[model samples]
Target: MPALKLLKLPPPVTEEWEWQMNASCRDIDGSLFFHPDNERGEAREGRVAAAKRICEGCPVRRECLRYALESGERYGIWGGTTEEERRATRARRRVR
Candidate 1:
């Protein structure tokens, strides 16, 4: 997986509080930067869920997930999708 370093931008200097559930950004081409898990699937899931709580307060979640899937990222949580889900999707695709 690649690295998405843009997600850590000082909370959007311009947007401030504009980031919502539908917000989207390039986020350094959407890579592994957003990954919070160091290999523990359960721990990562918990972290993603915790992050979702933050997204509930965010305005750019939708866009984030969209960018993630679009960029073929099989990493941390994005657009509400988990690494396992992405892996399953890839596995299914391979089966086809």
Candidate 2:
């Protein structure tokens, strides 16, 4: 069998993203309810979608996302983005 790969959970995320991620997912089963028929493969996508909505209604949402992206946060929820999404974004912005 191909070696079982272990996907890292990313580095420590900022307290703000952590709070938003947890908070948004608190009352709602964001994994399932927030986005209907959400497959695990699209978990990150779901988080991003949910994050936008949460940010729209949040007071310090921009600040939180700014802190996350500027600091190169590589973890759970950051800047209203998932680890994979963030990596892809940064990669594109890299000066080749």
- The candidate that wins on lDDT is 2
List the RMSD of every prediction in angstroms.
11.5, 9.4
Candidate models: Cα lDDT each: 0.58, 0.59
Error of 2 at 45 (Å): 5.8
For candidate 2, give the lDDT of residue 26: 51
- Stretches of candidate 1 exceeding 4 Å from the true structure: 1-42, 87-96
What's the lDDT for residue 27 in model 2?
Answer: 64
Alpha-carbon TM-score of each model against the true structure:
0.44, 0.42
What is the lDDT for 35 in model 1? 61
Per-residue alpha-carbon lDDT of candidate 1 for residues 1-96, written as tens digits (9 for 90 to 100)? 998676554544545333442444323333333663354677655666665555454466766665666678866666666767767766787899
Model 2: lDDT equals: 0.59
Query: What are the runs in model 2 whose C-alpha is more than 4 Å off?
Result: 1-39, 42-52
